[model samples]
Target chain A: MVTAVRAWPRPAGRAPAVLGILCTAVGAAFVASLAVGAFPIGIGRIVEILADMAVPGNASGSFDQDAAVLLSIRLPRAVLAVCTGAGLGMAGAVMQGLFRNPLADPAVIGVSSGAALGAAIAIVGVSLLPTAFRVAGGFLLPGAAFTSAVITTALVYRAGRQDGASGMHSMLLAGIAFNAIAFAGVGTLSFIASDEQLRNLSFWSLGSLGQASRDLVMTSSIAAAVGALLLWRLAPALNALALGAAEAAHLGVDVRGLERRAVLLVALVVGALVAATGVISFVGLVAPHIVRLACGPDHRIVLPGAALFGAALMLAADAVARTVAAPAELPVGVLTTAVGAPFFLGLLLRARRASGL
Target chain B: MRGVLLAACLTLAVTHASAAPPARVVSVGGAVTEMVYALGAGTALVGADSTSIHPSEAGRLPRVGYMRQLSAEGVLSLKPALVLATAEAGPPAVLEQIRGAGVRLERLHVRHSPEAVRENIRTIADALGRGTAGDALLQRFDADWRATRTRIAGLPTRPRVLFVMAHGGAPMVGGRDTAADAMLELAGAANAASGITGYKPLTAEAALAAAPDVILVTDQALEAGGIDALLQRPGLALTPAGRAKRVATMDAVLLLGFGPRLPQAVDELATKVRAW
Candidate 1:
């Protein structure tokens, strides 16, 4: 069915325009997030509040509580959601191109698991350190996760090499091994943790945006933006790689450099997000696939389109998380699974039918 | 005048005091054990749950297994005449079995309110033939509690606080209706995470949302990532609590245990919050 779909002609510029509309829709949802919550604030109040914040001494009693709520809570959450979503989406797009497989994701490379293990160690092992040594442990977790991810990818790349040539299958197997090892490490940490620590670890491992702050959001967004831009520059090369390494090299693509840069960028984006949020699953896996369905296989359109769609999906999921249980919010990751799993299954079934498999 | 004299004579002839029954005592919970000890009737305690770990000497007594996972065999082994228990003390079946065995079990109410605590103390005292002792202890406890609270009452502002029970992984926080909240209120500090109820896992985002002035946690919990781990948690690092090094650590058992030494814990907490 995928090949059949590929045979169909698509109108020029339609996908980008559709993506533009999706971006606007996501932006509107972001605004809606600012307006709705336990505080009972409306859109008018939200606008007024933003206006007041922008202009000092602008007397607006209508937006006082709304302003406080937005400035203090909603804005940070929305921004974080966008950054996380965009990062995951772009990373997914890059992975799919590099692997020449639509199913490729950040998780397939064990980046999320590695980051989670790092976070768990930071949380569980920091207590044993001296007071002077304790000050660095917080950043150390994420730092460790990033380092581990880079190392893991390097090792994966190395192990996947056959007579100085690497293939998607070898990379996939290495990723599986890395993910299993990281999960085992996390399990060990969980086992030795105190009952209270165990509870906290479980919740953290589930992934949440509850910790998104202005600084965190900014840092994560910047990292993701950088990754997206780099991936955009490498799009034509990625497109060539999709046709197979031998064909791509023959077509003047530096397959090794392309693979290295793409893997590194994915690691950085996934590591930064996971470090901040603790292993939010499925966004990277689903976002690229969804965008591909709408826009087809061209990396030029697929990369940017995935970023916008991914942000929209995550923000919508987060909005659902905040409101579904009212004041007691569910974890953002849980909400994603509840939505993403079904969508994923549907895609799988559709693909099976299309392929006659 | 003669009618008044007849009424006085009748009142004098009618002595209204009756001897109360000695509580057939089966103290079924840890808190109940402490209360029993507070009531000066530790000897009357026929049995206790595994969590009744206070007063040091209470451990030598027979254990009735864990608090929620009660065993009928362990409880019935004591052959308690009357069972005094906290609301949390049971696997309902074990409690029922004990009751079916003709054991008189009184469920002592647990509350976060100061008045409730005093009343519970009095109720336990009354059951143990030491009502006067309960009254006297309460008076002292109340006086000291008020004195400590009053000292901080004059402070210009109260600190917004977050009470973290566990550190590392996901940090669990105390919201409304929790022992941590009750303790914070008594210490004259506001709970940052008051929007929810009970013990909830606070997201880094929610912690940042609360923007606590003081991050309160137990020593053991803080040790997980030490100060670094606390600071590294998304929103926590930028908060006043994280910035000013206003993180306060208290003994976990004393802070949430709600035992005989809570007044002291309150005093210590108030001092820390005031300084913060």
Candidate 2:
């Protein structure tokens, strides 16, 4: 017995203390990201500008420009990073719980690839249509991504189901197939793309947070919040699920319903995130794994903790991405992969070693 | 006696068959279209690819689609007698299909140097059977290029420049063998990213390593992140380029398009490079 990790929901809770620390860390990272840029605005000036904006006409003159820059640009970008990270983290946790495989991620389920294929088709194919039809091309990108994610997930579920039951192995196999098809589609689109279109697609595929508009941030944050809340509700069930499906069933967990809900939740969260920010990889896998190692696999604590940790990680990664090249921003995805690839390899090695493979 | 007569008649027909003016010429690449127009053969043009949007009237011509992903159906529908294309044109299969259809296809060589551009113009003009007009254009262009070169040669020192292609946050710098590199060289400025060949994504470390005195990019790309954002790239802060604040942006098409206006571009670039 793993003692059910009573620290998560005990009368004298330690979860709040952990949450507080994470919040403080996330806040500090946000401030650091804003302050440290090529322009090099001081922390005091940043706060003073922010302070003026909060209370109307507190400070007059040129401070409004600083406030506008911080509020309109950096604030939205930081918020987007946090939301995207939280969404990916929550999706990853849910996926791992549903599949009972620590290796499971949003990418592993083919959601990211599907979204990518959808975006590519929208961007590339729509351009081939007549000029009148081209007016709607902008919406097609995200629309295609969202539609493809939903379709791919539904197909995977259908294909993986055996006697109305889906095992981790079957789901993983289906995901692999989906990813292959999606990638092939993307390749096809790339073949026909113009030099400019190819450049745009390549950049978009690598992922970026530089285009974080206020509307995008708001939509992403809402989607993330909703997804996180849903995951929160499933935490207790997820904990039971870790005990095995049979034991979970005995504990009044409807395994089928839980699986369906978890898959849907993961798909929605991942689809929204990918649609908004392109495919930012590894946050889902890395964040949950870190949280599991730190707090020991208690779903109640792990779910929220993973969300916070993921947000912090993304914020930090984005900050590094923006500041590292100063004027030249590396794609957030590139930075994530540069960090994530090694961590992923280590996870695989650890898993193999533990299994005595 | 009859066999001899038939053979003689066949020989006569073969000898007298003169190549007709391309009744419906379809040009795929923008540079190819410019060359055709410069050769005074725009009257032969029936349709053009999407990028053939220069010379005002070229924009009025029917577009067959993008250069690389050209539709065989769209192109063939134009009923072209000849298709003039660049080496970088098509989805390969489409080009193959057009060739298979027995369309007279001429793939023009993409050139970088002023001399190469002149040679390309001559080759295009000869292909279009307007060699005389082409000779005149070449002479004028060559004179202009030589005069610009002379002005640039008189400069005390050529500044080291980095030509950025596509930049997200980090700069994608042009190196040796690229059109931009050739243009910079022609303008008498040394390319900072000459350590590498062709267009490549420059690592912040590598970018800083080049120690460019002036950062050159297209106007649109500059609009994205601007000077301050470009200067902030991680390892770039330590570079001489970032400190000196030497950044020059020009229109991409004019800077590296290798058209007749290239002399003007070269002269303008020389002026900017020589300023510091």
- Model 2 chain B worst lDDT window (10 residues): B12-21
Model 2 gets an lDDT of 0.74
lDDT of 2 by residue, B1-276 (tens): 436534643453454335334556888777778878877677667778777876777887777766654544456656676888877675444465566556778887776777667777876776766667788988889899889878888988878988877546446778777888899888888999999866666688888789888888788787787878777777566677778877788877678778777898899998876566
Scored against the true structure, residue A227 in model 1 reaches a CA lDDT of 75
lDDT of 1 by residue, A1-357 (tens): 123223324436568687888789788878777666544666776777788778988765452433544674567678878878888988998998888777788888777777777777776776677989875444555566667766777777677655555466788898898889988998888765644455556766777675544566577778877877887777777777777888777777767777778888888887787766666778887888877776678777788887887788888888887666443356789877788879878977887898899
Candidate 2 regions exceeding 4 Å error are A1-17, A57-64, A130-139, A164-167, A340-357, B1-276
> On a 0 to 100 scale, what is the lDDT of residue A302 in model 1?
82
The CA lDDT of each predicted structure is: 0.71, 0.74
Report, to 2 decimal places, the DockQ of model 1. Answer: 0.02
lDDT of 2 by residue, A129-172 (tens): 89997654444666788789878887887777665333666878
Report the alpha-carbon TM-score of model 1 versus the true structure.
0.56
When summed lDDT is taken over every stretch of 10 residues in candidate 1 chain A, the lowest stretch is A1-10
